[model samples]
Target: MFCYQCEQTAKGEGCKTMGVCGKKPEVAALQDLLIYALQGLALVAVEGRKAGVTDEEANLFTCEAVFSTLTNVDFDPERFVALIKRTVALRDSLAQKVKAAGGKTDFSEAAFTFQPAADLNGLVKQGEEVDLKNASDDNADIQSLKHILLFGIKGVAAYADHAKILGQEDDQVYAFIQESLVNLLRKDMGLQDWVGLVLKCGETNLRAMELLDAGNTGTYGHPVPTEVPLGAKAGKAILVSGHDLKDLEMLLKQTEGKGINIYTHGEMLPAHGYPELKKYSHFYGHYGTAWQNQQKEFAEFPGAILMTTNCIQKPQQSYQGNIFTTGLVGWPAVAHVDDKGCPSLLDKVKSAVGLGCSSQGKDFSAVIKKAQELPGFAADTDKGKVMVGFARNTVMGVADKVIQAVKDKNIRHFFLVAGCDGAKPGRNYYTEFVEKVPSDCVVLTLACGKFRFFDQNLGDIGGIPRLLDVGQCNDAYSAIQIAVALSQAFECGVNDLPLSMVLSWYEQKAVAILLTLLHLGIKDIRLGPSLPAFVTPNVLNVLVENFDIKPISTPDEDLKTILG
Candidate 1:
């Protein structure tokens, strides 16, 4: 098995033995087979669409299947096996429909018929044939472009799935996913075609993110500035991780008044800023840092834990039994909650931790016990407050102030130090980069990466906080909006503005966001901890020449270069 779709791929190359993310060879092979099947389904779907035979289910399934293959999302090989078989059936059914509609059904046999191996060995062989590198032409630049688009679609699917759960759907984005997958299968396509498709993937991801932004803000109101406690409370607690607000909301509703307090962890930290979620008195503060620290943090937490989405590391034996996964996230024995919100898991939490009973007549005791525990938020201290919820709306609300600050020279430059956070070396670059930003500059950040220096006192410039948390990685949309707005205000292009993007990528979501930035014609962006392994030297040269993309250097050196 070979895989290198993430930042932590083995030795910055393909993971041949097992995924550095703890995915075994069987699981890796199954994922490869699943992607191949999805491409097959896309081929049939694209042909059927030509004859006016469209399958929304096929399009949606393709998006979700790709998402499941992302790092840390799913580890159950059995699940992938089922998806592969189901996808093949779906593809065949679509092919029949295309023929019935009198569509031009002349396509490669591999696109029409994909028989997934019934055993692990057979699957591995099938996987080798369809490996990302092998599927492409021999040109390294073309192969890199194809991978950039494929990984971008995977990111789009994850964000689209989140919005879909809230009943938001865009037919065009789904159609684009199918269209792009089918194009990747074409051996006759040229370099220009691949480049155009990569940019289109970026443009489409922007729409996907817009759908998600609407779904989230519409469902849970716009996020507002709110303080989140970094400590835990006494009595039984349930630590929730990942980026699913809907799951967190349902859990909050179910456990409300049941004596079990809910605490946010990882990307779920942004949930505290939502007005509807914060209204729950039982809702407490955050428990730990980013996803990379979950093993140690989950083990130390005194209550149950729920991972609502990706970024879940393999659970340790210490907390495996108490950990539950929901949505697209899956593990071998960990409990899962479905879309309806699993209430049994709440009961399991109650039974496992004994949160159902307390001293002061069960009601007052929970609250009193929590109050007695170490205060998660020390109201008297400055460390308790860190500004967040500065998405497009909040930032645009103060556009005049920001513009005036720039004119007044109170704000010199804007640095977007954003993207995923990992435990790998050189990650400390982000912390140091944020720390070294001049006081006259504004730092805008998003995703779990903000946790690096979020608590630091960067101060404010002309009433605007120096460090602004811009929602999750998908909120790269928000960052783009802010940049466009600033550009309009300054009467110049985004690149001409006094702004720089210092990004750190760890997963496919970052892949999609990078494409979006490139699609918008933003240049001179710095990306690290290191370049993707799949990006060959020739491809890297193309990016440097065309888009001015650069790997990161030391913070001091990069700062001098950017500032100059």
Candidate 2:
């Protein structure tokens, strides 16, 4: 199997044996096949638009198919196998309807079909043979462009998938996903077609992101300034990871006042800032940092680990029985908490760890006492003073300040250091990069990536913290807002502003954001700890010439280069 849609791909190239993320060969092939089937389904939807397919049905199809392939989200082969067959059936039925209505169809000769479990191994062998046979494309550059577009859609699907789980689905976004996927599969397409899809992916993702922001903010109330604790209490605790706010919300509601202490883990760290979630009296602080640290972090914690979303490396057998997965996240042997939709992690919490009963009559004054000491300053409470909502809207509101700052040299350069976090040691570059940034410059960060330097006392500039945590990774929307606002204020393009995006990516969400930046023609983005293994040299050149994308170097050197 060949896969390279992430930073840690085998030896900085495609993973031929097994994924560094611990994805087995069969799973990798299924994911690729899943993506291929989704493209066919998209073609069906495009035709179904003329026939009678509802936008809601199309949206669900795109979101689920895309989210299923995101890094670490699903590993249950049985579920995926069933999903592929179902998607293929949907695609074929849509195609037949289109043909009957005399509408155009792009169903290629390479139409995907389902293989029963009994024939799964045979199909896998066929896929391997096809990979070997089609190893050489007629034009290498064309293949590279297709890779960029396909990977970008994979990223877009991830964000769209997350939004769907929250009951926020957009039909246009699904149409774009379908259209873009169909484009990648078209062997007759040219560079312009691929390039257009890339930019549209960015614009549509901006909309997809807005839907999620509304869903999250509307459901959880706007995230307020709140400090989260680092240490877990000496009791039965349930460590929750991944990026699903809704699932987290449900879990919090079910476990409330039941003596079980809910601790946020990994991507869920930002949940503490959401007012609705933070109000939970039993809700505790963050358990660990980022998805990559889970194995070691979950080992000693005295409770079950509920992974709500992706970036979960395969679990060790030590805690397999205690670990629980909900929603789309799955593993081989891990007990899945929810089969239909929302399952009772509440009951599981009680059964697995004794309902956190050790402190039955213990006083809770000490936990509250510890939290009062460290209140974090996120987006909510800083309104007017620091301009709380930097999401494209609020940034544009202060457009003049940014332009004036650049002109007066109060802020000579803008640094956007954002993306997902991982366990690799080279991640230190993010910390050093923030440290080495010039004093006259401002640092904008989002997502768990900011944890690298969020604690540093960078002081303030113009009453704004030099190191600004905009929001979560979805909050990269804020960083883009700041850039575009500055551009409009200066009456020049966003790239013309003195801004450099230094991004570190780990999962598909990062992939979507990077594509969005590329789509907007944002240039000179320095990405690392390494470039994606999936990108070929030809595709890299397209990005370099058009967008001037660069891989991260030493913090000091990159600082001089970006700020010069």
Candidate 3:
């Protein structure tokens, strides 16, 4: 298993023995084979689209399957094996549609003709043959570009899947994904063309993110500023982690008035800002910081834990039974709440929180019951609160004041210090950088990386908070919009604005978001804790030459460079 799709591959190179994220060799092989199967499925889907046949179910499944393979999402080999079989079934189904439409169905690419093994052992063997390091490309630079595109597409699929759950659908995004999957096998493109396609992955990701923002803000109502407690309310409690809003809402609804308090964990911390989710009286406050610390955090938590989507670390034995996974996030022997036909765990109590029911069928009753059975917080604890929901809507609502403050020199500069978090070293740079951000400059943060300085008392300039908590990483669209709006107000390009992006990436979503930034022609951005292991030096050089992207250095040095 030679996989290096994330920032923390083994020793900053491909993971040969196993994944740095605790994935076993068998799971890794299955994931690789799953990708191989998805490629075939995508090839057939692309052909179907050319024949004017687009299956909505196929599009949604493709997105979900691609997203599940992302780092730390699903570590269940059984799940991957099932997904591989589904991919072949779907691929063959789509191929038949293409043939019926008088289109050519046969292809030379092995992915188009690949077959899955009958069992898990056989499947893992098949997967080992098509692992990422064994891609057909021998050119290091081209392979790097292909990896960038593939990983970026995974991120895009994540956002697309989220948006689809919220009743938002974009056919062109689906088309780009399917076509790009097949294009990975293309021999016609030059290295520069591959570079263009990689950037286009970023371009397509912008649309996927836009749809997610719309689905979130449009359904849940634009997030307004809300202060969420870091302390726990003594009672039955359910801690919801990961980034799925619908799961959080469903749990909130089912647990309502049952004496269960729903607390946000990790990326779900942003849920408090949304009006629809926050209105639940039982919806409580945040628990832990980010995904990497979950083993420690989940163990200490006094109630049931639900991981929704990605960044799920292996559950500590102390709290494994107390943890439940929903959506595509999975772990071996972990209780899952994904049965669509599963009965509603609680009686349907009326609530106004109708923010799209695309993901409503799952029964969170088991989680609620576990919460009821467990002894919740022994007593009330007050860790105070942090301000959130300063997304595009709220920030733009104060556009006049912010523009004036910038003009009046009260606001020195802007730093968008955001990205995913990991347990690796050097992450303290984000904490230190935010701490060292000059008082006059505002720091805008989104994603779990905001955990570094989220609770810091940075005060405010005039009425605006010095540190703005943009939504989750899913809301990168909001951050981009905020930058564009500020640039438009100042009548300059985004790069010309006083804003600088210093991001820390840990996974594919961050990769996709970075690609979006690059596609927009934004320059002079600093990215760290470390560059992706998959990005060869030549590929890095292209990024540096084309976009002035660079790695992060010391806080003082970076501050001096940006501020001076």
Candidate 4:
């Protein structure tokens, strides 16, 4: 499919035969089709805006369609085909409505269609399917810019979709997603326009992140520092992966006192920091590292694995029967959780109960008893000397301090190092980058990507640690808020400030954040472990010339480049 949009792309190049994430040819083709369908849907919504469409429906569609295309979000061809059909129907219906009103409508031009790999000659001889390679775009740079916008929109769609699922929805974020996608369909779009829209994607995503932060912090409490145990107690256990707090909360509630111990996996590890979630005695600790390790991690664990979102990998048959997927995450054989987030997991947990060896004998009463003794810390509960509200508000409060820090050289430069994590080896560049940051500099990070360096003991500059993890990747919103606050405090534009963004992208969400940075006129940002394959040379030119977006190199070299 020529998909190199993720860190795990084969050989650091495009995944031609199959996705390194274990996505098959048909699945990848369907995903592309689904994305195209969503683009069409975005076009409809954009036109609907002129016809006075309510922002809610338009936004909802934007979020869902985008969510469907995220890495590992949907692998089930059945589910994907259904979504494509739904999107096509939505576009068609909207077009009809517009037609009746005598309004003109346009859709994104279709790039390519899917066919069996065996139908192709050379690639077929190599056992690979020829997929959509964006061949229709005659201009290399415009293709790259289009890819940046397209990928960014996909990323925003993911975060907004998750927020919507939590019973929290924002109309503005959705509208921006629709508006952003539709704007890219124009053939004559300028580089400046693309760059501006990219930054706006970041800004809107920041708002989406803020909305989710509020939804999460308001629903749960602000995340606090909490130590979670690694292994599970003696009982039936269910490991929940991906990044959906509401799903975790509901699962914790349903499985609570039912003798099912719930463990957090992958990005869900941070959920333990949230107040409302950790209150459940049955909630266990984190399982493994990033989502890439899932196939092996899930093998040894004894319980049901519930995938609530992205970063899904092809599963081994050993645990295949026990895995359950909900929301946008899907796989061929895994049982699908229905709309209510209910899957037949409990029965599987029950059946596997007496089959596997227990962490202890019988019940986990002792572990649960021990957990209650530990106290939790969050925004409302931190009570620590270090300030926690460094989001937009706290940043404003300390605006003078940040400006003063820069003035006094206590903070040499500000670096926004953020994005998702994957199986790529060079991703260690992030660990080294954090380690190599000058003592006078402050490092701001977000997303599961930050886990690479978050645990490091980077001592404080004054009272603030040199490396400050703002929160999850979606909390890049918090990072942006802090940046804007600093810029205002310094009485300069954000791009003019002595701040540099060195981002490590693994998924589409990073795409949106990069776009947002560009939209805000932020420049000289470094992005790596690798540039996206979807980006054409022309697109790269647009980014390089306008935003100064560059690939990462040695931490020493990059540090010198940014500092010197």
Query: Which structure among the candidates has the greatest lDDT?
Result: 3
**Superior candidate under TM-score, 2 versus 3:** 3
Error of 4 at 20 (Å): 2.0
Worst 10 residues of 4 by lDDT: 352-361
Model 1 Cα displacement at 303 (Å)? 1.0
| Per-candidate local distance difference test | 0.81, 0.69, 0.87, 0.68
What TM-score should be assigned to candidate 1? 0.91
lDDT of 4 by residue, 1-564 (tens): 667667667887678788887787777776766665566677766667677654354457557767777777887766655555555555666777766665567432651122223222322222222134753356666666666667777788787776766556777787887776656557777766766676677778777766777787788876665666654466666788888887677777666766667877777776777778878987766666677778898887667778878888888998887777776677877776544322232332233211112112123232334233322211121212221223444445556776777788888888888788878778899888988888888887767777677656678776665766566677777677787777777788888888888888888887777766676677888888888877766677767897788999899999998889
What is residue 223's positional error in candidate 1, in angstroms?
1.3
Query: Whole-model lDDT, candidate 1?
Result: 0.81
lDDT (Cα, 0-100) at 230 in candidate 2: 72
Model 1: per-residue lDDT, tens digit, 1-564?
778999988889889888889999888877877888888888888778789998776777777788999889999866676677777777777788899999866676585667877776787678777776567668777888888888889998998888777667798888888888877777788888888998898898999999998888999888887777675555567788889888777777767676677888888887888888889998877778899999998888767778888988899998786777766788988766544323332352333321112121111222224323422232222226455688888889999999999999999999999999998898999999999988899999999888888888887887788988888888898889999999999999999999999999999999999999999999999999999988879878878999999999999999999987
The list of candidate 3 runs beyond 4 A from truth reads 342-360
- Better by lDDT, candidate 3 or 2: 3
> Candidate 1: where are CA atoms >4 Å away?
341-385
TM-score of each: 0.91, 0.84, 0.96, 0.79
By lDDT, is 2 or 4 better?
A: 2
Who is ahead in TM-score, 1 or 3? 3
Task: Order the candidates by lDDT, highest first.
Answer: 3, 1, 2, 4
Model 3 C-alpha lDDT versus the unseen true structure:
0.87
